[model samples]
Target chain A: MKRAASRLAALSLALLAGTPAALPARAQDAPPATRPSDDQAEVLAKVEKYLELAKSGTAAVRPQAARRLAQLGEPARARLVELAGADGAGLAELGPQVVEIAADFGDAGLRAALWRVLADADFPWRGSAARALAKAPVADEGAAFRGLGADHLWQVRFAALDALRALDLRDARAAVRALLVDQEGAVRRAAAALLVDWGEPGALRWLVEELRREDAYFRVPLGAQARFDAHKRLTELLGDDFGFRPGESPATPANAAALARLEAAARERAGDAWPSELPPIARAAGASTGDVLGLELRSCRAGEFYLRWNDADEVHVGTGNAAVVTLAPGTVERLRAGIERRVAELGDTRFWGEAGCDLEQYRCVGADGELRTWLLSKGQASEGDLRPAPLDAVAELLLLTLPDEASADPRLDRLRSRARAALSVLGGAL
Target chain B: MISLRSLLPALLLVGLGAAAPSAEDATVVQMVELNNVEYQIGDDLPDWVIALDGQRIEIAGFMRTGTLEGETWFDLTNDSCGCGTSKLQHFVRVTLESGTTSFTPDELTLTGTFAAGEQEDEDGFVESIYRLTITSL
Candidate 1:
């Protein structure tokens, strides 16, 4: 995933020349062009400053500025939109420039300007504003949505369909739903998508009908001409040195091996490690509460723990894959040791009997107090549900998991060994 | 018996697949956004929503509101494999004998039920389907 994300970043940078990693698509593809660093920034500053003079800027200036800003992508667009969002005397100065910018940059600006225009009802600007928003990468979704809910113009209402179709805000489901009855076919199409994204009950009924009706993606096998066309297009995506041998398919074994090696090297980073050491995915677990470590895996299953906050009152909390422990001042240190010891013990154990379960999907759980020692089963076990294993037995289990001098992820077992010892001390303290 | 025109598009309804919907006699065909999966009939078909829940949905107004024009076949399964999950599809083509047989130009309620879906690759919002159901009304 890390490699994939970096590759994506590299591809985007390639599309947008001049940055930290701006290697042209091909050396030959590099154009004889050079641009100053702040060239884009200067135009943007002026656009903000030239709001009153939006129409007055040199024909080339604002258009270039808007185009450059679009290239700055979402981060820049987000900043501009946010500035517009903050209302004040600055709006009048900002408004017209925004209008012109959206119009000037074509589809890109149109998408950016959609949200701001949705906030205003001023006519000529509003209509163009809406159209700009729909140019391609959609915008103005939330505003048009809020308006269409009570809008008078069916044209505007119809445009609402387009607005919804273009708008991709995750939280705007409410606004989208309000336009469900829009009087235009375009509007209905927008509604279908919104309903589907948000999983509205009605959207399904409608989609099922549409699905049965539409077959747009893939059809029958292509004819000879189509196949040739596909081949031509596919070649465009092929890299240089694609055909290792004269006229040989670029997808041959030797080339494939080289490409695989390059890809592997490119994607060397691993994902962030999961936090298995952290107990109770929640916060605040204490010895006083019979709160066992609680972890909830995925969204489906849940677990609970009954831990005592201190030496007195019993605290019970159930969590799976996560927990919160609120131990007394010294409790943390002691339990950390206990947990480490237990991990070492568990690791050393030969066979883990899950009764009837996949051990991979299970984990070791334990809790103890001064009076009673509780060993939890891999699945869900409660206060009285523990079966005590000898401390040596537990140590044996830990040894099994612990790595020798040359293993990977060895730290996990090592950490467990140390944590279990502290846990035992804490249990004895209580 | 429903023709492939309407019945076939029913198969494409899983996830967000196409913008140009099938069905020659589209009682309603307008673009809309699937914001929230407001309500679903059965299982994990989170893409659909119900208008009765008062969730606002964006839609292009369709001139024709469908009623049980006649018995039209409907598919019950949302799985990509085409397995039927409910008895619902059997009745879709079977002239939906319901009160929602017709629609007004005004954004009408997609009362049957709906499911929201993923977004499209192009410039449109996500696709949603409103399975208009007909009760004794």
Candidate 2:
């Protein structure tokens, strides 16, 4: 199996290596006269300023800057390309943003630049290129996605799958099917999601299997949103009861039941060929607490999602417009224990709040019907009207109920990770 | 011709006589100043921001209504549209101290107590980041 996996990886690398050096449809194919009109020097300077703001400026500045650059259109493309290719300290950070900015042009230069980045095997920004290309609405979508879908890098492959799914390319079904059993859960989930979007029976079967696995958590690094998308797709394909919650840990009975129901539904929809019995949850070594806990984290604009423990013995998690649905079981006792131990370990660690970031509040109603709430700021602030992360047990419980904030804000995610780390620290006086 | 959009804010600031107000008095806070992106991802906040807490402050932005139509509070965003509800980092929730107003596209300048922290609704949502109990608009 290891050898086979290695061989598959090698084959994927080989396929990526064999991609065409240049697409016939690219802007660079034209003569030098085809180069886009450059912006006025002052305008270019403004564009540069916005670009800088988009990178390291204030939140208010970043989005506005990005919007300005996008509105500037082709005038900003050349500079964006230059920044994307620069070897400066933070230039690489601009790759994804550049790709997004490039999409506004939807011109040949965007296509050409993306192709150049993706075709070059050693390109530092291949992942960004793939992601950008996926959304670029290129003329030759099939060849681009086909070449990239077999990329050695999991990110590139995932992007390719995303592109295929978005484009609804029927021919790429075989390639997408191959990724169903990928080594990475994200890749597999992406592949399954693509299939589900395409309404393929194979996707139904694959998702059911994922629901049955021991490590059923559909966590993909920086991909809680994608996982949520797949869960929604699955629920749509199966019955309403089969809807999977995005942030809910897949270890819950409600999730298991949902998966089981989904599997049965898939069998009915796709025929009896699909597997019937998914792997059952193994009992923990010690006596487990059947206590269920619900946690939620919401920010004003950039973050709004919750994981509520419903009376139906299910975790109801919501991301975007999707209705609250069951996910795998959450580790309520373990999480509470982790919070308690960490709070005890670090006596009186100060918690601070920020001006722009949203307040993260965690609420857990105990089995005894005692409701407690903990309000946490995204980060530690020294002087502001601040609420500390688990400033007390109530606060800690709120931090524990962190649903993946898919607000597309890295700051919120980092705050969630920080809260989890602070709560998970076993011991050591600070 | 020069695009007036970029220069408009500077011109407005000049008109408003942008000056540092005393801590006991009112301070002017721009969305850019409040939502500076330079801060690191974790919980540690910059000290300069801590100084702004509990201060009477003034800010300018576009006004937006809350999730529910009849809700008394509205939001102020850097963008004129004030469209998206997520990313609280880019907006300030504004509650009028006196009368209520409908949503408007034009930028509105308001004065209020700049309250900052995590405030959750009964339904478990972060209601605001920078909230202003508006004394004037």
* TM-scores of all candidate predictions against the true structure: 0.21, 0.41
- Candidate 2 lDDT over B26-84, as tens digits, reads 67665644543233223443444444556667776655322223456777775332222
The list of candidate 2 runs beyond 4 A from truth reads A1-45, A58-64, A81-94, A212-229, A239-257, A273-430, B1-137
Per-residue lDDT value at A19 in model 1: 59
Candidate 1 positional error at A384, Å: 90
Per-residue lDDT for A4 in model 1?
Answer: 39
State which candidate has the highest lDDT. 2
**Candidate 1: what's its TM-score on chain B?**
0.22
* DockQ for each model: 0.03, 0.03
Question: Over the true interface residues, superposed, what is the Cα RMSD of model 1?
Answer: 26.8
lDDT of 1 by residue, B69-104 (tens): 233322221111111011221111211444333211
